[model samples]
Target: MDIAAIKEQLPIREVLQHYNLYPDKQNRLRCPFHDDSTPSLQVYYKTQTAYCFSSNCATHGKSMDVIDFIMYLEKCSKHEAIEKAKTLIGGDNQLQRLTRQAVLTKMFSYFKNAVYNSKPAQEYLQARCIDYRQTEVGYNAGQFHHGTRKDEALIKSCIEHGLLNDVGNKSRTGDTAYNVFGKWCIVFALKDSSNHVSGLYFRSTLNNQDQRHFYLKDRSGLYPKYPATDTKKLILTESIIDAATLLQIPAIASQYSVLALYGTNGFTQEHQAAIQSLTQLEEIIFWLNADQPGAEATSKHAIALQSLYTKARISCVKMPQGEDINSMAQAHDNMDVFIDLLEQRTADFSFSIEKENNNAGEQQEKAKLFIERGAPKQPTKTPPPITTGELDSTNPYKLRYERDTVNYYIQGGLPKTTDNMKIMLVIEDKASTQKARNRIDLYEDKQVEKLCKEAGEKLSLPAATLQADLYRLTDLLEQLIEKQLQQARPPEQALPVLTAKEREALQQFASKPKLIKRLNELLGKAGIVGEERNRIFLLIIAISHKTADTLHALIQG
Candidate 1:
């Protein structure tokens, strides 16, 4: 069989229809050569060619290639494949015919009218919080009737420049408008490789109301549309509004191309394929919602496309807490903050195993003991002992006493004798003070023992001599305690009542600035005018007027 004759006799459409190998509304086909899960192979009726689009196995070729593929699948030679192709064509010439541009023009017009007049498409936009009129181009009722809405100014300008039909629209919905038969619909236009209007979408504006209402259109992948001359970068957002929001940023104003994904959940294989086909695309930034699902989808799509375009860098732009891009734009006129955030953005899912391992190693080292085992233990240092005078003079203790006494005096006061007794008991039994005193005594005992042992070992002296020194130190401690107690005792049998002279002197000391100045001068001369001495003197003055006996007892204490 002559190969050229066989090609002319092949019924492409009939074979496709017989095997259910027809392209969907988008002119896409499943790989007949392989068990493809999706329609990874596409047939362009206009070009009369087929191509495999799977990333794993992109085996694209012509009609002859298709015959060759069938031959291979059926385990037959080229002659057998030709015979099978003849049988599949069934002598149908209509199968080989392609639809003309006039049909596309008619389809676009029908859908555009359906979308503008359809209540369902209007409601869908409303439900999604999108206002068609608020977009860059105003809506045209007549254009809707014609199945295309071009920017009037853009069309007029292009027409003047002899560039007619240069403007077009890409529907958010996929290709289904070609089948819309008197259904409520929303429509958008499709553009060719030169960005000329090629198709239209007509979708149901009403949702969840009826099963028969559905329509969409796409003219994207076939277009060789170059971004505006000023566009050097591209920003991919989840919505058209979000894409507009990017243009609002001065940094990105004319420097980038902005495209909308329509929604987070609506990303399909066609969308991915469209994005992957952009040869001029250098970098793609996924500016999605700052939400869990949005982030997840962004990551998934970013990863999927990264393989298709190696230079593509993916980063997520998070909006302010609880605010979306629309709300943020309303709150702030400038996009400085948002742009800054984008510039500083990083891939949230990308991480380094080596860094994590280093962190773990550092933590393990931190957990190890600092000191080596079996080293001689260093002696614990003891704090300096507090003498009875210092204890009685301290501001903390004096303040405590004053506070209690003031409260007591206001409350008709505790008896003087009872107060003194309570003070003594507290000094002896309070846990902190008792602990401190015990530690001091234990340290002293250890020192004495150490001294005696050292003397016995070094001077060959009797341990009894060191024991005598320890005994003398103990006697001195006892004497100090006795003296403190003796001084604390009252002089009178029943504490002497305040005399008139004493009362006058106390009042004068408290009220006269001259007297206070003189007292301070005398205290300075005596080298006792510092904080500790002042506190001691103040305590003495505050409690001294109770009785001569109390004053003497306090001095001793």
Candidate 2:
């Protein structure tokens, strides 16, 4: 609101302090835009702007107002700087509001006409990667109703609307009206959701000027000035120029609607209301500048959208660091960069509050399911306590535990079990490291007992301990052998044998190349392979045929 008034009234010192920047007794501070060794920025209270004398600084020898300083410090757009300026200026209505639609239209038309006349302004827009012809943008030469019969009335109205200023003297056209936007500025028509022009946004063509961004007194409205009622997807950008930049890309403009925020803190009540009205909205993606403030804003707005529109998919497209859409578009002449980055949007927990909530809900649901189903059984039983000996080639398996009679073994670094079909018994001297290993066959109990006795005598261990160990080993071997036999030869039922004629018919059916190819394809889809797959194919064909006699099949391993 009243951007000119704010710049005049708001002191540069106050703006500095708001950002926690303090100037010494000399009213100087280190330049924040670049690496500075000392305070090179000098504050001029008379002009209410700060200038850095450091040649290495980006703002070297340039006077920056409250808005410009904010833009540089926040690494945001000019529109964002204006929004930040509003906060520093305290309240809205610093000047009278421009409510006359007729006058606003005339003003917009004048600026729109100026774009065609000025080649430099056109080049500036083109350099910024903005399509002024397609998108509703203009060049403000700061000439409002020059040399017209209605000059006095127009000047008075423009002054009241903060579009013109009274220089306290009559001009060549006999009016005290001085255009506030000045010469060489790009004009953008900021429109409401209903496609009505609500305000005007100005960006200076002069790079040397610090206060390059300016908005109409009442900075309220979205860019593009169109109905978003049918838009299923929406793109939110940080600046109007960035939104305009997206509008130039046919791919983006055709499918998604772009809404520009003034700054990181620029999401207004009007923006919220406009978005809420989009009943058909399926997704909302932020294409803000790739800076710290932009990142923070993207997350903040994404969370807000999640809370407000739970069904809408909220996400953000990360640009190159410190680059915005317009700058990136300008760098790369093609739209593929935008499309590629759009495909890689981050809308998960970082951006979406609903995603976080859903994750928590999913975890709770999993816990509930576990309770209802009963806790899952452990894949293996708890292992026995073991004191393992050093690995050796002779005894590959480690000792699990040393009982009074014998030592148990852990086979293959895992818990000893009957499934592995490997077991060992170690008989060792209680006083020394000497030990004896006895390997026995599961079927030969007496032979294993004889070997155990001989090994025990070699180690000088008690005969009774060796005998007890032999008994224990025999029982374990018996169970393991039984388990192996059961696994290797599972129970089977008797099958009827097919007649010679039926078998001949099945063999004939399985010989077709087309059928075999189709069968292989199906088997491939089911992840079946090798010789077993061929057997299954034959089996399928055998079962599909109408056979009067029962079928007997033999498969090779």
Candidate 3:
């Protein structure tokens, strides 16, 4: 069989599954060629290609057709890769041909008309800064059309087209999947190379997490087409909304053809075919989320596209650290910086995908220990005392850490108060140089024991309890601090201090027997006695009794 025939026949997703090179819910994977802590490989099922977005790895931007995958995975020559793939694919099943394309187009047209007339869907696009009229937006009449509100014509047409699974609409009675058929949802038509409506995607206008995007089984793995008028530049985004937003930009609209992957993981063989069709396309830039996964994807896709289109320049336009393209577009003040960055062909910094990170390894171990020790059983607002460097309260370990500082971890559960148990993990350097693996306890290791005592004191919890369960103790302490923070006024707007003259004027009231009596009582509440409490009492009195002659005189003074 010809190599191209085999490539066409082999279901890349199945082949990837066969090799245990799988994508997650987000359709990301660690590049097999690199020791990636984060998944960097994006497998485009429709495109039948995989790209390692890890720029630091040798395979960075390396675009692999199924044959390239075989070449890389088997470390074989072209002929060998083809031969090995032949064994892997066996007799591969072909993609299910979409038979009702014409029907789908008609339904999409009706839905698109519905969306154009629907006030809410129009507002939804307007709110997203998308011009529905100009952008070819449609509506998905989600779980709303029922009883008298049902569009029988649409339903009958869909049934006629065999577009829906259940013929009589009996499934809509209660079947979760089938019941959703006639519901109103916003529709977006995905186009193929010939500008034919190859797919219809339905996205809910409301904030429903579970039902974000609804695609018919036949339409799966297709990219939403955007015009590639300037074949020299192509911009790929993670979502249709983002793609639409990018196209609205004057610079982007004039100089680029844009495509949306529908999802982070939705790049398909069909999209790859469309990309191959971009004969004059020289640059393919990824505009994805600026997160760990996004960064990895940007790198993976960039590398893949560069290799796939060796003649084309492949680079990434980095989104501002925490902003997505939509948010960035909305920020009128930030457009210049964003546009400047997007105009560039290379990234300032792409994370190291191939480097073996000891910190990541240690954090993974600590997370294992945290979970094993029953984190859920003793839940805390503050995380476990795990450190992956940086004081991000977001990390699993809530332990405070300074770069290159010595931090200790205990083995087993909690040790007795000052029992001086052995330390299992020791973080010596901040960015790197993390060391951990069980070691014997030294009886003379008083320093770690002392740290425990200090922690107990700082936490205001009994030493025994704090030592017994670090996670629970931290939780209690964090809860208390959170409560206090909630009650306390912000420091910037704290009550004003009295001047020296006011203090002297208020000194006269200090001699009052009732004042002295109350001041002494407050000493107990304040956890102080004698001079310190006396001064605090005077200040308190001055703050509250501003109308008193002595206090007012003190304030005036």
Clash counts per candidate, in order, are 10, 0, 34
RMSD of each: 36.1, 28.7, 26.7
Across 1-557, the per-residue lDDT of candidate 3 in tens digits comes to: 88878777565664665565545434467888778899889876557788888887776767788888878777879999888777654333222222355446545644655664688888888767677766776776653235533444445445544445453344446632344552556667677655556767767788788777777656643444645544777888887778878766677677777888756666677777778877888777788876787776665565555547777766676544545677555433223434665764453222222434375564222111011221334545755654433332332212233323333332222222233332232223323444332233334335435544565454343445433333333343354446545666465767889999999878877876798567667666786655764565566666766554544324322
User: Which of the two candidates, 1 or 2, achieves a greater TM-score against the reference?
Assistant: 2
lDDT agreement with native, every candidate? 0.46, 0.67, 0.58
lDDT of 1: 0.46
Ranking by lDDT: 2, 3, 1
User: Which candidate do you rate higher for TM-score, 1 or 3?
Assistant: 3
- Deviation in angstroms for 201 in model 1? 5.7
Off by over 4 Å in 3: 1-99, 142-178, 182-184, 220-230, 333-338, 345-557
Sort the candidates on TM-score, descending order. Answer: 2, 3, 1
Model 2: weakest 10-residue lDDT segment is: 364-373
TM-score, predicted candidate 2 vs. hidden true structure: 0.45
Q: Flag the better candidate by TM-score, 2 or 3.
A: 2
Compared with the true structure, what per-residue lDDT tens digits does model 2 show for residues 1-557? 66787686565655665565755435577888899889999876556788999999988767888888999999999999888787655444223333455346556756775777899898998878777777676787765556432344445667777677766777776745464644578888777655556788888898855787888886767776643688798998899888888887888788888888888898888889888888999888888988899977876777677779988877788665556787666544346767778876765432211222364465222111011123454576654444333222222223244565445442222112443322334455656767665434434556656866687678776666666655565564555446546777867987889999999987886786687566667666787766666656576668766777646666677
Whole-model alpha-carbon lDDT for candidate 2: 0.67
Give me the runs in candidate 1 sitting further than 4 Å from their true place: 1-192, 198-232, 244-253, 265-281, 321-341, 347-557
lDDT, candidate 1, 158-182, per-residue tens: 2332223323444456421221232
